[model samples]
Target chain A: AQRVTQPEKLLSVFKGAPVELKCNYSYSGSPELFWYVQYSRQRLQLLLRHISRESIKGFTADLNKGETSFHLKKPFAQEEDSAMYYCALSMIGDMRFGAGTRLTVKP
Target chain B: DAGVTQSPTHLIKTRGQQVTLRCSPISGHKSVSWYQQVLGQGPQFIFQYYEKEERGRGNFPDRFSARQFPNYSSELNVNALLLGDSALYLCASSSPGTGEKPQYFGPGTRLLVL
Candidate 1:
C-alpha cells in the first residue's frame, strides 16, 4: 500500500535555528510529493511540490528517490513558520497524506 | 477568482442520523474531491468526481456517497452516522487533464456526531 510517514509529531526549534521536517514514503511507482501547511485559524494550503522544485517562504524540500524521502528544510526558522505541516503523495486517482508534524518556532 | 466553497460551516447530529454536505468548485475547475480531516490528523481522501462522473473513491463505507452536478458542484451524503464520523469535511477543486495539479481546498464543514 502507498503511505506517507511524518515521524515527528511535534518539532520545536528556537528562532534563527535551522529546521528540518522529515518525511518518508512507501510507494511502488513514481509519486508526486507535496508539502501542505496549515496555520492557526487558516485553512490548509499548498506549500510546494517536488515537481516544481521551487522554494516557498524560504523553505525547500528535495525528493530523494533512493531514500524514499522528501524532507522539508529551512536555513533559519521564523516564528511565523510555526504551523502544522503535512506531507502528501498524489497517485493517479487518490492522494495520501501523512499524519502531520506540528512545528513550533520559539523566539 | 473565488476559491472553492462549502456550505454549513458547522453541524451537529446524532448517531444513525443522515447528513448531506455540499461543495462548489472554483470557477473553471472541472474536478471536485472530498476529504475527511480528523482533529490533528491529515485529510483522508473520500471521493473524486470529474465532469459529472465518479473518478475515484477512498476506503470508506457504503454509507458515504457523493455526486457531481452539471455545474461542477457536488454533494456528499452520509447515512447511519457514527460518533467516529465526526470530522472536518474538506472539499477541493482542480482542473482536469493535467498531471497532478495542485488541489485548492475550501473552508471545511465541521461535523460533530453525538
Candidate 2:
C-alpha cells in the first residue's frame, strides 16, 4: 500500500517570500509523484509531475527517494499561487493523495 | 474538447438506498477512475477502469461497485448507502497507454445522505 502525507494542513506566507509545502510518501518500489492545485471556485489541476520535472507557475518539486519526500517549493510566492495543494503517489495502477495543504499568501 | 463530465451534479439519498453516478471521460481517454472525497479531506481511490476492464480497486467494500462502458464512460453504484457515504464522488480520466498521463478530474457529484 502507498500513502502520502502532508504535514502542514495550512501554510501562510508573505507575498514574494519563499514557500515550501512538505510531502512524504511510503512505497516499496519506485513511485511517480505529482503536485495538484485547486484555486478557489476552480477544479483541481495538475501543477507538475516528477517525471516531467517542468516548472509551472514558479512551482517545482523534486522527488527524494531516500527521504521519501516530494516537497513543493516556490522561490517567490505570488497571491495567485495561494490555493490548496495535494501531493500524490502513483504506483502500479493505483494512485494515492495526501490530505492537502492550504496555502495563503498574505500581502 | 470537453473535460471529464459527471452527471447529477448533486444528489440526495437516505440510508439503505441505492444511487448511481455517471461519468463521461474526455475525448481519446481510455481510462476512468473513481474517488470519494469527504469534506475537508483528500480524495480516496475507489476504482479504476481501463479499456472497459477493472484494472484496480481501492479499500472500498463490495457495496461499492463500478463499471466502464465501451465508449470509456463509467458509473459508480453504491448500494446500502450509509451516512458516511455522503461525499463528493469524483470521476477522473486519463490516457493509460500514454504512460504516466495525468488524470483529469470532474467537478464531482455531491451526494448528501440525510
Candidate 3:
C-alpha cells in the first residue's frame, strides 16, 4: 500500500519567516510527488510537482528518495500563503494525499 | 478553459437513500476521477473513468457505482447512504499519461448524509 504522511496538522509562522511542511511517503517503486494548495474559499490547485522541479510562489518540494520524504519549503512566508497544503503521491490511477497541513502566517 | 465543473455544489441525503453526483470534465480532457474527502482527512480515490470506460476503482463498496458518458462527463452514484458518506466529493480531470498529466480539481460538491 502507498501512503503519504504529513506530520503537522497546523503550522504557524510570522511573515517573512521561512516555512517547511514535512511529508513522508511509503512506496515500493519510484514515486511522483506533488504539492497542492487550497486557499480560503478557493478550490484545490496544484502548487508544484517534483518532475517539473519548478517553484510556484516561492514554494518548492524536493523528492528525497533516500529518506522517503518530499518536504515543501519556502524561503519567506507571506500572509497570503496561509492555506491548506497537501502532499500527494501519484500511483497508477490513484493519488494518495497526506492529511494536509494548514499554515497560518501572522503579519 | 472552464476547468472541471461539478453540479449541485451542495446536497443533503438521508440514510437508506441514494444520491447521484455529476461532473463534467474540461473540454479535451479524456480522463475523470472521483474522490471523497471526509472532514479533516485527505481525499480518497473512488473511481477513475477514461474514454467512457471504467478504468479503475477504489476500495469503495459495490453500492458505489459510476459511469462515464460519450461526452466524457461522469456520474457517481452511492446507494444506502450512511452518515459516513457525508463528505466532499471532488471531481478531477486530466489527460492520459504515465507521468505527463496533472489532475485539475473542481471546487467539489459538499454532501451531507443524515
Candidate 4:
C-alpha cells in the first residue's frame, strides 16, 4: 500500500528563520507528490506540486526518488507562513495524504 | 469562478440514523471526490466520481456510498452512522485528467453523531 509520512506533527520557528517540513513516502512506482496548506479558518488549498517544479508562496519541494522524500522547505519563514502543511501522494484513482505538520512562525 | 461548494455546513444526527451531504463541483470540473477529515488528522479519501461514474472508492464500509449526477455534482450518503463517523466531510473537484492535477477543496461539512 502507498503511504505518506510527515514526521513532525508540530514545528515552531521565529520569523525570518529557515524551515523544513519533512515528508517521506513509500511507493513502488513513480510517485506524484504535492503540498497542501490550510490556514486558520480557511479551506485547504494547494501550495505546490512536485510535477510543477515551481515555487509558490516562497515554498518549494523537491522529489527525491532515491530518498523517497519530497520535503517542503523555505529559506525564510514569515508570520503568514503559519499553517497546517500536508504532504500528499497521487495514486491511480485515490490520493493519500500525510498526517500533516502544523507550523507556527512566531513574531 | 466559484469554487467547489458543499451544502449544510454543519449537521447533527443520532446513531443508526442516515444522512446525506451534497456537493457541487466547479463550473467546468468533471471530477468530484469526497473525503473525511477528523480533527487534527489528514483527510481520508472516500469516493471519486467522474462523468457520473464511480472511478474510485476507499476502504470505507458499504454504509458509506456516493453518486454523481449528470451535471457532475455529487452526493454522499451514510447509513447507520456511528460515533466515529463524526468529522469534517470535505468535497474536492478537479478537471477530468490524471491525479497529478491539484483538486480544489470546498469549505467542508462538519458532521456530529450523537
Candidate 5:
C-alpha cells in the first residue's frame, strides 16, 4: 500500500522568511507525488506536481528518490501563503493523501 | 470553463438513513473520483470512475457506493449512514487520458450525520 506522510501538523513562519513543508512517502514502485493547498473557505487547488517540475506561487518541491521525500519550499513566505497543505501519492490506480499540514505565515 | 461542481452543498442525515450526493465534472473531463475528508484530516479516496466504469476503489465499506453516468457526471450513495460518515464529500475530475495524473476538485458537499 502507498502511504503519504507529512511530519508537520502545524508550521508557522514569519513574513519574508523561508518555509518548508516536509513530506515522505512509502511505496515500492514509482509513484506520482503532488502538493495541494486549500485556502480558507475555498476549494482545494493543485499547487504542484513533481513530474511537471513547474514552480507555482513561489513554491517548489524536489522529488528525492533516494530519500522518498518531496518537500515543498518557498524562498519567502507571505500571509496569503498560509493554508492547509496536503501531500498525495498516486500509484497504479489508487491515490493516497497525507494527514496534512497547517501552514501559518505570520506577519 | 466551469470547474467541478457538487450538489447539495450541505446535507444532514441520521443513522440508518440513506443519502445521495451528486457531482458534475468539468466540461470535457472523463474521469470522476470521490473522497471523504473528516475534520482536520486529509481527503481519503473512495471511488474512481472513468468512462462509466469503475477503475479503482479505496478501502471503504459496502455502504458507500458510487456510479458515473453516461454524461460523465457521478453520484455517491451512502446507505445506513454512521456518525463517522459525517464529512466533506469531494468530487474531482481528471481530463481524458490523464487517469489520475492531476485532478480538479469541487467545492465539496458537507454531509452531517446524526
Candidate 6:
C-alpha cells in the first residue's frame, strides 16, 4: 500500500522567517512526488514536482529517496504564502495525498 | 487554453439519491482523474481514465463509477449516496503521452448530502 504523511496540520510563522513543511511517504517503487497548493477561495493547483526540481513562488521541494521524504521549504515566508499545502505521490494512477498543512504567515 | 472544468459548482442531495457530475478536460488532453476531498482532509483518488478506458481505480466502493468519452470529457456517477459522500469532487486532466505530471485541476464540485 502507498501512503503519504504530513506531520503538521497547522503551522504558523512570522513574515520573512523561513518555513519548512515536512512530508514522508511509504511506497514500494519509485513514485512521482508533487506539491499542491490551494489558496483561499481558489481551486487547488500544482505548485511544483520533484521530477522537474523547479521552484515555484519561491517554494522548493527536494525528493530524498534515502529518507523517503520530500519536504517543502521556503527561505522567507510571505503573507500571501498562507494557504493549504499538500504533499502527494502517485504511481500507476494511484495518487496518495498527505493530510495537508495549513500554513499561516503572520505579518 | 481553458483549463479543466467541472459542472455544477455546488449540489445538495438527500441520502439514497444518485448524482452525476460532469467534467471536461483541457483541449487535447486524453487522461482524466477524479478525486474526493472532504473537509479538513486531503483529496483521495477515486478513478483515472485514459483513451476512454479505465486505467486505474482507488479504494472506493462500487457505488462510484466513471466513464471517459472520446473527446476525453468524463462523468462520475454515485449511487445510493450516503451522508459521508458529501465532499468536493475534483477533476484533473493530464496528457500522459506528453507527461502526466502537474495535473491541471478544476474548481471542483461541492456536493452536500443530507
Interface RMSD of every predicted model, in angstroms: 1.4, 1.7, 1.9, 1.1, 1.1, 1.8
Q: What is the TM-score of each candidate against the true structure?
A: 0.98, 0.98, 0.97, 0.98, 0.98, 0.97
For model 5 the local lDDT of residue A91 reads 65
Where does candidate 5 stray beyond 4 Å?
none
lDDT of 5 by residue, A1-107 (tens): 57899999999999999999999999998879999999999999999999999999999999999999999999999999999999999865578999999999999
Q: What does candidate 2's lDDT look like per residue over A8-102, in tens digits? A: 99999999999999999999988899999999988878899999999999899999999999999999999998899999888656889999999
Q: What DockQ number belongs to candidate 6? A: 0.69
Chain B TM-score list for all models: 0.96, 0.96, 0.95, 0.96, 0.98, 0.96
TM-score of 2: 0.98
Candidate 2 chain A weakest lDDT stretch, 10 residues: A88-97
DockQ of each: 0.71, 0.64, 0.62, 0.79, 0.76, 0.69
Best by DockQ: 4
Off by over 4 Å in 2: B96-100
Q: For model 4, how does the per-residue alpha-carbon lDDT over B1-114 read when each residue is reduced to its tens digit? A: 779999999999999999999999999899899999999899999998888888889989999999999998999999999999999999999976754479999999999999
lDDT by residue for model 6 (A1-107), tens: 78999999999999999999999999989879999999999989999999988989999999999999999999999999999999999878668899899999999
What is the DockQ (computed on Cα atoms) for candidate 5?
A: 0.76
Regions of model 1 farther than 4 Å from truth? none
Question: In candidate 6, residue B54 scores what lDDT?
Answer: 89
- In model 4 chain A, the worst 10-residue window by lDDT is A88-97
Q: How would the docking of model 6 be graded?
A: medium
What residue pairs are clashing in model 6?
none
Candidate 1 C-alpha error for residue A87, in Å: 0.4
lDDT of 3 at A10: 99
* Model 4 C-alpha lDDT per residue in residues A46-76, reported as the tens digit of each score: 9999998999999999999999999999999
